[model samples]
Target chain A: MNQSMVKVFDIQKDDFISAGEASSSVKKILKQLGVSPEVIKRAVISMYEAEMNAVIHGGGGKGYAEFFKEHIEIIIEDNGPGIENIELAMQEGYSTAPGNIREMGFGAGMGLPNIKKHSDQLEIKSEVGKGTTLKITINF
Target chain B: MEEFINSVTLDKDKCKGCTNCIKTCPTEAIRVRNGKAYIIKERCIDCGECIRVCPHHAKKAVADKLEMIGNYQKAIALPAPSFYGQFPSEYSRKKLLIALKNIGFDGVFEVAAGAELVSAETEKRLQTENFKKPMISSACPAVVRLIQMRFPGLIDNILKLESPMQISAVMARKLFSEKFGISENELGIFFISPCAAKVTAVKSPIGIKKSAVNGVIPISEIYGLVHESLKNTEDDNQTNIFSSDIGVGWAGSGGESNALSSGKTLAVDGIQNIIKVFEQIENDKIENVVFIEALSCPEGCLGGPLAVENRYVAKSRLKQHMEEAKSEKAQIKPVLSKAITWSEPIFPSSVLKLDDDVMIALGKIEQIEKIEKDLPGLDCGACGAPNCKALAEDIVRGIAKETDCVFKLRERVRQLASEMIELESELPHTMNRTEKNEN
Candidate 1:
């Protein structure tokens, strides 16, 4: 919430190699900040996978990150075809990624599950055709 | 334990300070500082991803050399079960042992025997006390360290059995000293490592006081010697070379699964694959899975860092060796028992902590919030963290500060832009003189 040190990133869809780029930068920052390994790991996993989802399914997205002494917060917003069924998406091994993606070793249907697993707190906002936004926080 | 000395090293000059490894690292063990790479020893799992990806080959693996064994009176070679995968089809076990002796080693022992022993011990432990569900294999030292750092919660799942190499080294020393009437200090044991993590493991063993292994010989360096031995059957290979199918099979993934003969076990290869399985376990999703075998490298020990052949080639060679294993029943019991000792419990160490105190964690949280307000939230590595909040924590640790990132300064510039606009409107006449002076 502090006005001074807020960070922002613009993520693109289908940029596979660059999908986790923003999250990587975030993780580096967290480490230099001397955040506990546990908290930084959680924050990185949540943010990176979420960013990947935006690129893979949401078409493209934007990321916002805020650092606190004890917590790291991340927000991802995408203006793509949003989730039609959040419950189905949450299920393990229920991936909607194309076969090509699977062949590349991703789209295991564990993306959302992984994001949720790593975040201390996670919130998702999506509409079928409108867009989606994800907010994740990890307390150190 | 050797106090968890991280054997993995960083050659800073070659690092481009890119965040590639930082992003890919499962444990966030890598950090780019002052335009080079730095590894946090406490957090590194020695998984070798950075070594695999470093463009400049800056992330080199550190291991003991074969020459180091010369310092001892008697040098012994303890080849891992994966060692068989390095040779050609004609490379006989006796020939390999003979060549090891020729290479100045007094004796050669298969690490598979130790693995067999540990496997038996692990089996017994499973039937007893109510342990963490889906007990993890302790053979892979990298995996053990991974649990120590990132997945400390999963430490309960780590089987308490000592690594086969460790057990083998101890046994080799004991048996050789007893037969030869030599002092223990005069005997040297060198593990032919499949990967760098194993080398690190022996140098700094976990759950034990001192390492039995005095040095490590990377499999890659010894491959040529083994190949040469196979070509020259002219030398007498009269020395007895011992091992079994179950023991040798420990070289590849699913070898452990086959050894345990557990119907509910799952074998996952590659560090990334293991990470995925670990996540599933953390979620408690795979409930029926009783045992999990995780290899840091793909295709198990054959895919270790010190290996010479590709994983596929090594796998085929390993398979061929398994099929050729002598199946006499009488040879089974003694070899199985003598090759390994699965009696001792490999207990998990308590490394994971939720927090020293909830109040302290809370206070740190509040400070991070205040720091965030001062940050520009660019999530730039210039500040050395992923985002503003992380920068705040860095400030707490005294590693980084708010102004380290250029984005925050840009925000300040933008904020000042509006103020200058308002000042121009208020004092247009005063600006005219200063503007004329500049012209």
Candidate 2:
């Protein structure tokens, strides 16, 4: 009686045009699976923020979404420069993004904080120079 | 009152069974089966994309004929704002309305006037901080249905007021009954629509319990009669047109947003374009915009499938109508001062889901992905489905077969031929005695 379906999307560094592709795809899938609208909205916002952060701060990344009967799990992993301080990054308006990226209307430093606000359960594992991996889960 | 699921219907004989409609439908509501195109009832938003795409003129919008007006003691025409764009600029809107009244309607009420009331209400709502960001306009019935079907979460984001058509019909029914000393039931209220969706909206309303309109007539169906009556009809009165210049501007895209006068508003027209913006809205990506005007038809109602004039020419005429559009204040008032909200809330439709049970639907999703992987990914629509993926979904739903895909059918045929060849080498010993002896 196992009930689970998984989808994976590849993210590219500085791929601003396609930053929200994974979140959009996940939204469609959840809708088809009879997931509630409110849940889908939260999943989309959180995933989109993680994706933008990956593209802007983390050099490049991949998005993994697994849907279960009771809850859904999403992971956004990146191999780019990882966050040195998780607490500081989680604060609103505290951004490490370069000034040029800020001009593009993104990198307002709300990425991690916004993701935390929307997701029910969030975990972040980061290695200073190697990468950052985020695991987010939302109850159905 | 016959309960038809959609206003758009098919003329089976004229259909060539082409995939045009199935490919073009924004909701994927159409499928070709048994050499004919058919519409799925729940999924059709009645946007009339099929009517616009059908090559043989097979698709038609089911509308009320003028003859039906004889059934009522009093019949009033609630002309949509877009109705003004159907004629040349020389025809005064006041005259055009008189022509409408001359045909069969006992009275003519401008829906644009109702639109002005709605605009004022929306302006007030925009000031309240409790509303959702990027408040989506619920003016177009098709866009409202689109949100219910695809973007259910945004339903709360949709403006809560009834459309101009509904608001006008209510006001017309009230005013006409009070003015003539006639009962409301005896009064038949009809709307002049530019597209098929409005007809469906009246019949099977979404948010409201019921529509005040009794019938709907496409502008095309009654245009010729109105044109003929325009020659002899005299000016009814100075109060003939109630809507202000901005209200009449609602005929084209950006009109509703323009009527808002202030705030960061965005207008997106055409069904496909609306889908893109809705996707952005779902992602919470669109920033700072307080209101959005989304229309189903390209260039707004002027480009409706049922509209007769070329959109561009009608657009130029619309501008002229706007300039001449009445700026004078109306003398009569019955619920015309503000917009009335819908009685009920819209619930999301689950027609797109694979199954009711999450586990079962998940299993079906896996099957669809597996089947899609085997497909050629051509999206050719030769299989009577919109694309290979659609065919896969249908297969998992048990409505279609793998052989429905021509490539898959060919592969199956090749496999069967090879199996037959293998069977030829396995004849019984009695029938293959010479071969057995050689072995």
Best by TM-score: 2
lDDT per residue for candidate 1 within B254-372, as digits (tens), equals 99878885688999988888876875565344657788999998888888867888888989988888877755221222323433323433433332222354344445545766788
lDDT of 2 by residue, B192-263 (tens): 989899988888887788999999998999989988998797886633667778778898999999988576
TM-score of each: 0.68, 0.96
Model 1, range A56-118, lDDT digits (tens) per residue? 888897999886656768999999888899888888889989898778766778888888888
TM-score of chain B of each: 0.84, 0.95
Top of the candidates by DockQ: 2
What 10-residue stretch in candidate 2 chain B is worst by lDDT?
B325-334
Q: What DockQ values do the models have?
A: 0.05, 0.74
Q: Write out fnat for all predictions, comma-separated.
A: 0.00, 0.72
Which 10-residue window of candidate 1 chain B scores lowest in summed lDDT? B328-337
